[model samples]
Target: MTERRIVSIWLPRLAIENWQRRNADWPEDLPLALATAGTHGQIVHDLNRAAMESGVSKMSRIVDMKTICPALKISDADHIGDTKWLARLALWARRWGPWSTPDGTDGLLIDTSGADHLFGGEPAMLIDIQDRFASAGCSTRLAIAPTRGAAWGLARFGSERAISKTDPLPYVAPLPVAALRLDPQTLLLLRRLGIRTISDLVAVPRLALMRRFGRANLAENPLLRLDQMLGRRPEPMASPEPPPRYLVETRLADPVMDPSDWLPGMIKDLCDQLAAQAQGCRQLRLSIFRVDGVGCDVTARTAAPTREAGHLLRLFDGKLENIDPGFGFDVFRLTAEAVEPLNAAQPGLDGEDTEGLALARLIDRLTARFGADAISRPLSYESHIPERSQILGAPVSDAPAPLARADRPLRLLTPPEEIRVLYAIPEGPPGAFIWRHQTLRVAKHAGPERIAPEWWHDRSGTRLRDYFRIEDPTGLRLWIYREGLIHDGRGAAPRWFLHGIFA
Candidate 1:
């Protein structure tokens, strides 16, 4: 197997760095500490180098840290949000490679393997990554090696060693066994046994090490890690996740409290950006983030895939008024949630447009006022049953479907209505029918049209139907059907049903 090169970017103060990004006025050298709830009380989760140097360290009690450093800065830790920020950075780092993952809340691991040459070489790439985080006010420790385990340890402890694949053992052996990423108890046990460094640990036989330490962990756990770090064992990584796009965001210079003050312009700005990125998308989401860390969001979908800013704004006009911006909001983001290909429109020479397009826009507005399910359209389906052949589809655009054409009633009873009938001839056309408490006499009529039940489905209770178009005395035409055949093998008697009436 080919050797792999992994780069570890460690942010020792990830939560503090995230907080600093939000508040730009924070001093670079200020002593800052972040705390999280513990069984006893708030405990320090992370701290800046300034705080660490001032005799306040991580895991120290919040009150104790404050007492130690009178002018220290402290805040509560948002671990989830901090991790998300780290993941986002890792996603953005994909310009280098396709494999990037979160190491922890405070770090990221990137497999730059064959991609380093694009930015010059491995050394240049390392310097570039360091410069980016440094410029962004993110304190970082970057190290690159042939394995993730070694890269991780080097980033935390090694000082820009620039070690090669063949020289790993020599450089790594001198560091304490903690660089091997062992449990504290194991490290303590090894220290008592006069094995404090990787060199001392490797001096013992692999079989003896396995037998001695196997009970605490896997039989080859320590040896396996050493092998993995030295590139002797294979360590496959998970595939990198793709970054989300069709999104645009704008942060305000000043927070806007009232909806009227900022919504329209912000919507127009973000919609224009979305139109560029999401040319054939149907659904879009708008996010309003307040300065106080609360967010309000809304979604809009077009009847067809469209990128028109005017049409999108029209859909959002009334809905934007409903969002309450408590205190004030400072950031606006728009993302295309869904999309599809759309055919180009071809109007008539006389400037007449297709009714389908106009109808779609009308449905778009109506659904914006109502909801998605409130507006529907007829979609043809391939089915033998008459009523089951067509379905109610969303107003979204799709390819047209072919349907069977036959002389049928304008309206149909869901289940054909049973009615009293008088036939002109036995086992023939209906002379008259009484339906819904009304008596009608046939003046003229059309002959029987036979339709059989679908054989593919259940045929137990189904029978052949003979339909007729009959005109009543008042000139009203009624569609009627007779179920069951006259001389078929079925034992049930023939019955009449009122199917529908023609306009």
Candidate 2:
């Protein structure tokens, strides 16, 4: 097999170029720069040829940039939108090769080892790539060599539109040492040592270079990059990862009036297709398209990844009626929105679904009716404080079902109500109190159970509470508390409050 030849493309002004392509009638005389929020201050992220010619460069302070070019136009960076444009460009580049990966730093790497012949010759291929981008109104540079490292170096450093494969070390020897992609600190040290070019570094013995740089990091990256360009070390071209897509649509010959009869069968069919594409899908969205040209979506999510047809049908039950099919729904689409990998279930004899799995389906139905955040489940938290221990979270899992604590009330009030105490000691619990415009006498009372806040969590404004189980006249058990310890001589005088009621 022949060695793979890589082609590296550099679009140093991609951010501004993409903006110019999308928006027409941009001022040609004014300098443009894209700015993004930085730790120090708003810094110049990407500048155009006009901005650079005005002595404004990338990383230049926004303040100084205005001084250099008063008419300099700076705009917020739309990184995501720019990347999408690059993705479209990548699809266009794929006609030349099967594999292409985004360099993520204003460049793209394409494996064109055996693809040059498709365009007749190497020179023709380079011209075609240039012409394509030129037609799109974007300027670019291209280079090809035996190794990716060599192609990257030549593309960025060599003064040529394209450089054919040659002795890599000699070809890159005269290029600036920055072509090696070394960090700024390392490059500064090398410059201080009078090693300003690749040729100068090649003259220095490897053992001597190791003794100087190997101490900081055992793997000498500068030497390794040089070796890869010289074909001494292997550097493989990595392809871009494709995003996961899951969608299936089905059209019926006749619109259905009764959803229960037709929707179940259609849902089962869509689930089969979705299972084939992605079985480990956690969130699913079902879109119902009506004959009246109206559409509505019903979404459901499971605690864990699932793709069972029966479970999916049950989860989406009654959801089809929500679309209000006036003329009836003629099309149904099931899509996997959020996904996670899960082990394939072992095929077994047909039987009913497990009870444990049913909990997830129940939660799914509840979430479909009420919004996902509308419902919550309680769990026994690690905190000792009664209120803090009752941890409430969304109904997304069944591992921690709501468990009632006998010591704590089932329904806890958000803000404890202050009862008008008719009589009580100066530094003691309430003997009797006025509640709900009715005086209720205390039949019996439990001893004071003192509970303090988690000291590690908060050391400020946290007072210890003394709780008491008091029985009212109507046999109603009330959980009351007095704020702060009387003996500690800390905090305000004790106040009584009704926290919860235990029936």
Clashes of each: 0, 0
Off by over 4 Å in 1: 25-31, 161-163, 218-220, 240-385, 388-503
Q: What 10-residue stretch in candidate 2 is worst by lDDT? A: 213-222
> Can you give the lDDT of residue 402 in candidate 2?
58
230-261 in candidate 2: lDDT tens per residue?
88888776677442276665657688754556
> What TM value does model 2 have?
0.48
Candidate 1 accuracy as TM-score: 0.59
lDDT of 2: 0.74
How do the predictions measure up, each by TM-score?
Answer: 0.59, 0.48
- Report residue 128 deviation for candidate 2 (angstroms): 1.3
Per-residue lDDT tens digits of candidate 1, residues 160-257? 63545655787677778777777777777878989877888789988998787666553236777787777888766664645335665665767787
Task: Go through the candidates in order and give each one's C-alpha lDDT.
Answer: 0.73, 0.74
